[model samples]
Target: MSPVLLFAVSLDRAHLQLLRQRYYYATWKADGTRYMMLITREGCYLIDRKFTFRRVQLRFPRRGVQQGCFESHHLTLLDGEMIIDTVPETGEQKRRYLVYDLMMVNHQPKIKLPFHERWKLIDKEIIEPRTYDIKTNKYYRYDMEPFRVRKKDFWMLSAVGKVLNDFIPKLSHQADGLIFQGWDDPYIPHTHDGLLKWKYAHMNSVDFLFEIGEGNRQTMYLIDKGRNRKLEGAHVTFPDDQDPSNLSGKVIECSWNPKEQCWEFMRVRTDKPTPNGWHTYMKVMRSIEDNITQDIVLDEIAEIIRLPMYAERIKLETQALQHAARRR
Candidate 1:
């Protein structure tokens, strides 16, 4: 069976109020291909959004007395994205899988657990053990592994500046926006309102299926599974190095240019099988017109936090964290 995936909704004015209602952990949204890693006795595999699985030539240590140095006896499922990063010292590019959430660990389902608890389990069980092995040279065939596994870091909403100014600059891969995940949210399979993705107004983009017409003219279509709706004002010109014919039937991202009054080609979305639907396209366009800045979002959050009504909620959240920490 395939693991159901959760999708993040676009951040808007309505989402701003959610910050006051509950605590959220924020991280940079990586511009990479999303995948679910399943570790079983048979083998370790990467499952894509399209429900395609690719077995990896790797193994996980049994961690305890077994110490079998093989894939775990219990099934483990993880959510993450695959990214290509540049190694600073060697200036060489390498593929890395950045895991963000845990679904099942040791065959025990964690989908019902709070996001904070699930993340903690992923760190203690999956990330730490592997890291310790690598550092101590325990020899789990590290040299034979195709890619490195990493835990994506999350921070409090107050640390948004640190993420944008400090963490992003140090990253070797591309990050498009900020992701806000509810601290107490359970793992909802699809379109979780508590999970939000926010990009800079100018950085907002939409994916469309590109088609070439007569006279080398081009048109863009939104592939919404049920229908291929043509998008107006989506005129595009490919880069000099890219061939239009080669890009036919491919999904391409485009950002609206206010001054130019047209959509500008951002890049080809090779990872996505289809373009976004009508709802997503309109939301992105509205976000662009609203032009909400990071400063504005921060200000809204600060204002909400100062209210007396949210005081008790903040206190309870703090206490919950403190209690969880003590238990750990």
Candidate 2:
């Protein structure tokens, strides 16, 4: 089955009061490879971030092996994080899946259901029973979704404090930031409300269509989707190893450096073409203003996250549409 993809709002605390509207939330770390797991009675399918898919056929238990388990019912189309680990002892790499969401099950769509409701279904139907795969002689089970936190408990600075101070340090996976999912809202494809992501100040980056200037010039302009050339301050300054001149027309990530008062290079984004919208750029700027560092305190982090933002994005978007319409 084809999967419906959804995009989350890059988290800015500015519009956080939207959370006050009777919402439940969960925090998940963004890391490793992303894939959508599609399960059917016939077999299981793996879909990557690009929507490329490969099906894995279901096989019955071997002749001599006891009847193991049937996980077709428990498994569903899910958003997942895949981590490849190299065994320190065996010098072999193993793939692991961390299921983040349940979008469908039993030939039915669950994305329309409330976040909490869908989670309940997943926990009771799948997690309690433990879904497994019988590949050759090995038993494989995917990881559970991230922990769900009650809004009230999560709102307290102490809870967030521990995650930043203790929990995050213990994780071996690569996490650019924490994802805040809305419990009461339905999963909508593409960009919508109910999903929020938070990351470190330095992790705040924007993708842009850039070009190398004439010879010996170390600077380049980052162009928006609208072909709006971001000149002057819009020119990104990458690391020494990255030849800015050789990166013509490539999409790269750039973050604001508050200390340097300029946009600095983060990395190159290969997953998709085109850059984030103006709203995302604004959010990055706001994050830079917070001056958050790796050793930030919990309260300070909370204040930075709770601050309202992107409030004008909707209006700006509408205006952009109208402008385009006028041109038409």
RMSD of each: 3.3, 12.7
Task: Give a tens-digit lDDT track for model 1, residues 1-328.
Answer: 4459998877877777787788777899888999999998888999986688899976565565235353453589999999999989998999999999989987889999999899988777887667667666664568779998988888766567778878988999888889999988999997687898898766788899998878878888985657999987668766688788777889988877788778777888876778888878877776777777888877776676566655566677678989999999
Please give, for residues 1-328, the per-residue lDDT of candidate 2 as tens digits: 3346666665545545454443434354545666677765667677875567777543322122325444345346676667654566686665566665678776677888987677666555444444223233344433232221111112222246666667667655456766666656787876665676667777776767677656655444444566655646455677788777667777777776767777787776665456666665666566556554445534444554443432243345457768999999
lDDT against the true structure, each candidate = 0.81, 0.57
In the predicted model 1, the residue pairs found to clash are none
State the TM-score for model 1: 0.87
Top candidate on TM-score is: 1
Local lDDT at 68 for model 2: 47
Q: Which stretches of candidate 2 lie over 4 Å from their true place?
A: 1-4, 41-43, 54-75, 84-94, 125-158, 216-232, 290-297, 300-328
